[model samples]
Target: MRYVKLPKENIYEFLGRLKEYGTLYAPVKISEKFYDFREVDDVKKVEFHYNRTIMPPKKFFFLPREKLFEFSISKAEYKETIENVEPFVLFGLHACDIFGLKILDTVYLDEFPDKYYKVRREKGIIIGISCMPDEYCFCNLRETDFADDGFDLFLHELPDGWLVRVGTPIGHRIVDKNIKLFEEVTTQDVCNFRDLEKKRAEAFKYHEDWGNLRYLLELEMEHPIWNEQSELCLACGNCNTTCPTCRCYEVQDIPSLDGDTGYRERRWDSCQLRSHGLVAGNHNFRPTKKDRFMNRYLCKNSYNEKLGMSFCVGCGRCTYFCPAGISFVENLRRIMGIEDKSCPSEISEEIPKRGFAYASDVRGEDI
Candidate 1:
């Protein structure tokens, strides 16, 4: 890992040069309090201090709606419709969002891989940035507040400039090609970086005893909290749409007027929706709101034993945008019979042995 300083004045120049690699997509302010990842037409439009984007960068890899393939009924010919797959760079991604992409990689790039997702993932370059936690942020508990990998280059904000960490060979190449734009890291810069980490850790307002979450979730499978949250849940699916890690999708075949030629399409789906579990003969696997609601959370906590992690990256998007006023942290406290605790700069180091493993255990550490 290499560290360097990027003067704030040269940020725009650096951003412009990054376009040489691919199309640059960064967080752009859409409204007074909302931000979204859009094409960086002008460097001035990018928002660095933004809390979170309305949608995660996962959209660039796994599109919301895409044509899988087109087929001819008469001739029985088929062709995969994956075009305009040019290389692209995702700039200013937060640590949690990058972890979300890693989760998607596990699902799409392992076992049976999705060719379309693989193509996009291969061409994508991830440049992460550091961020302070807001009231709704709890990635610290999930051990995703800081990322050690899964990014090409990561930038941490400093007073005089930004501290850049090169994580990959491509990241090293980017820094090497633009060596003039950066300065060597100094001793004070290193101390400031350590202080910044402490500041960010203390900034989180949402704290919880998450060590027992996995075990409690399994022990209380029939807990009343599920039923309680179900009544408030509108089945809106907003949480699923905004979540960086939610990957549920539905495939449909669109036919022409002749009913001979059509293309198969895949669009984002939500477990919160009633139609998600509906099948032929109208047999719904999850018929009630309680069942559907419970399924989503359970799916979030489901352990990926191969990867030694769960689906939730603790980005807080689901809780931040939930229309039903669902509080993820509070609900977890409710389940574990734990109460609200003030931010202490550190969470428990103990690891749970059941249900799901902590994010820090991604290297296969003993749970």
Candidate 2:
């Protein structure tokens, strides 16, 4: 690792130099308490201290809404249209958000490769920042406090300025090109940097023990807490929208103004929507709100285990955006029966249904 110092005042010059690579994106203050990633021409617009953005940076690569194909109505035929995405750099990304991107990489590039997503992801560079956790954050529980890989370069805030660490060969090239911007690291600098990170970790306190989350979710299939919480759920989908790891979407076709030609589009979809699981002939598998709610937890905790990582980064964005004030941590505790010790005593000798009470409904409801 190399140590570099960019005078707080000269940070703008660094960004200006990076613009030659491609368009640059950094956090910008959009409103009183909302920040977002936007095109950056002026380095002053970069808000490095932002706790979190209203939406994750994933939208840059896999847009929330995008055109997937174009169709000709006359022939009733379609042709796939690949987007030629330009190379770019993502700056000021937090560790939790980086983990989110890794999840997307696995889903889109490994399982079933998405050409559009892969093209964009391969062309971009990731520059991550170590952000101090806010009151609502629990990234440590998900073991995303610090990313060892997945980033080209990582920056840690220092009292004098910023300490930059190169994580990949590509990262080293950038630093070497601007060798004048950095200085050799000494034993004292390393000690100071490690000490700073140690102190920062203390500020983040785990709300609940997440080490046993997999075990808890395995045994809580029949818990009644899901039913109670579903009553207050508005199904607004704010949680999914704000969540960095949620990847569900739907495809649609839009006709041109003349109705001769049209383009197929893919828009972000939510599992909370009643029609999400609907099939032909109006067959809905998960009709009840409680069933859908339970699926979110199971997918995040249980299903993700098979994928080699937990889907939840513990960013707490879901709890922060829930209109009904439903806390994910609280729900996890309920599912584990940690709040009620007597729940284990009620376990039956015979295992009940596999939590498929609504399987009879083939036609899903509309959102």
Candidate 3:
């Protein structure tokens, strides 16, 4: 690991230098107490200190809406056009958002590989920022506090300046090119960084332990708590849309004005929607809100066991964006029976072994 220190005043210069590569996206204050990642031309607009963005940075790779292909027909002949993605840099990403991107990598890259996604991801670079933990955050509970060996570069706040830790060779190249913006890190700097992380750990206590998650989700399928919790659920799908790890999608065929040519497009879908599981024969796998609610928990805790990673990155985007004030951490605590202040078993008997070689091949049945 390599470390560099950048003076706070020169931070914007560093960002401006980074803009030479491509579009630089960072968190910008959109309104009162709300921040969102957008293309940055002025580095001063980047809000690196925010608790979390209203939405995760997943849209840059997997767009909310994209044209998969465009086709034209002439005399019963059809031709298709595919768009090429451009390279860009994602700046000021939090650790939880980084974990979310890693989840997307496993999903889109492991499966029948999404070419569009792969192209966008390959062209992009991640610059993660270590942010102050908020009350809604429980990433440590999911064991995703650190950089997770994913980001190109990770930054930590310091008293005098910023501690830059380069994770990949690409990051090292950037550092080498912008050597003027950074100075050699000392042993004291490393110690100070570690101490800061330790303080952060103590400050943010885990709402629920990782070991209790399996058991908590196992027998809670039929619990009346779900009905009570989902009573005010608008099913607006805002939570799923904002969630970085939610990758459900729907495909549709759009015909040209001539009605002879069309292309299939895949857009992000939400499991919370009633039509998410609809079939051609008018059959829906999960018709009730309760079933959909339970399915999300199962996917996050039980079904994702095969991947050896929980689907929820603990970014708190779902909880933050929920209109009904439903809190995932709160629900998790209730499910684990932790409100009574009793320690639960470390391991659950229902915890399944990792299965399948690829995430795509691993199905709920396998779990």
Candidate 4:
């Protein structure tokens, strides 16, 4: 990989020049302290300094709702529905989101290979920027703060200018086109970059014995912490929606008025709901709120180890956006008996009055 300097004077120049590549999309501030990834028509409105977007850049590829195909209601005829899309230039993605996309690539591209996701993936050029993390960030635990791979270009901001890493041919092309804007790298520049990495790491508020967290979670199933967390949880689906790694989707058929044609559509779904695992005869596997709640952590802590990758990258969006104020790290520590967790002030507003009954008192009994 080669390093090049993106001069501050050329920042806007770079955005204007990037329009030649494809339809440019970047983070745009929507309201007070909120950002969304939207199409860029004017460079003046693009947001550079932001903590995290409300939604990940994955929405461009795996859309929230997608129509799979149309089928005749009477006859056994079907036709696929896919748009003839143009190329997309997705810019200003942070390192945590980049690593989240990497984890998703392992599922959608590497394992089962979803064609629709692959189509959009190939059509986009990703450009990543270094993050200025907030108190809600714990990416340091799993090295999700920066990526060594998975982006065409990775930009690191410094006191003077932006340090850009050349990863793919697309990145090289950008540097080639704007050769005057990027300076030749020196040994001192590399040393300064290393210092930036250390500074970022030291900024995190939480630390973990990464290799031992899974084992710590494995040896317990009856922690009262899970029960208390469940009572506080709203089961509102915010965590699943905000999380970039939770890729569960639901499929359904919508019929036409004439009953001649119908289309099957798939939309983003959450595994946290009680109805998610429900089947015919009114039977549900994970009937209790605690069962559904703890399943999320177990999947992150237990199942991800089998895949040889960390699912809980600790971007901390789930806790930040949660109405119930459930912090993953705090609760995990409580489960492992790390920090003493008394009843949080956020939990006293409204307790979950009713919960589905289970045969056992232990957490995750139905899982």
Best-performing candidate as measured by TM-score: 1
Between candidates 2 and 4, which one is better according to TM-score?
A: 4
Local error of candidate 3 at residue 334 (angstroms): 0.8
TM-score of 3: 0.88
Error of 1 at 13 (Å): 0.5
Q: In model 2, what is the error at residue 110, expressed in angstroms?
A: 0.9
Number of the top lDDT candidate:
1
Off by over 4 Å in 1: 340-367
**Which tens-of-lDDT digit does each residue in 74-177 have in candidate 3?**
55544444456677899999888888888888888984988878888888999998877888888888777777578888989887778998999999999999
How many backbone overlaps does candidate 2 show?
A: 7
Candidate 4 lDDT for residue 215:
60
Please, what is the TM-score per model? Answer: 0.91, 0.87, 0.88, 0.89
TM-score (C-alpha, index-matched) for candidate 1? 0.91
Q: Name the runs in model 4 displaced over 4 angstroms.
A: 303-307, 341-367
Cα lDDT tens digits, model 2, 219-307, are 55555666778888998888889989899999887989988999989999999999898988999898889888888888877545434
Model 3's lDDT to the true fold? 0.78
Model 3, C-alpha of 355: deviation from truth (Å): 28
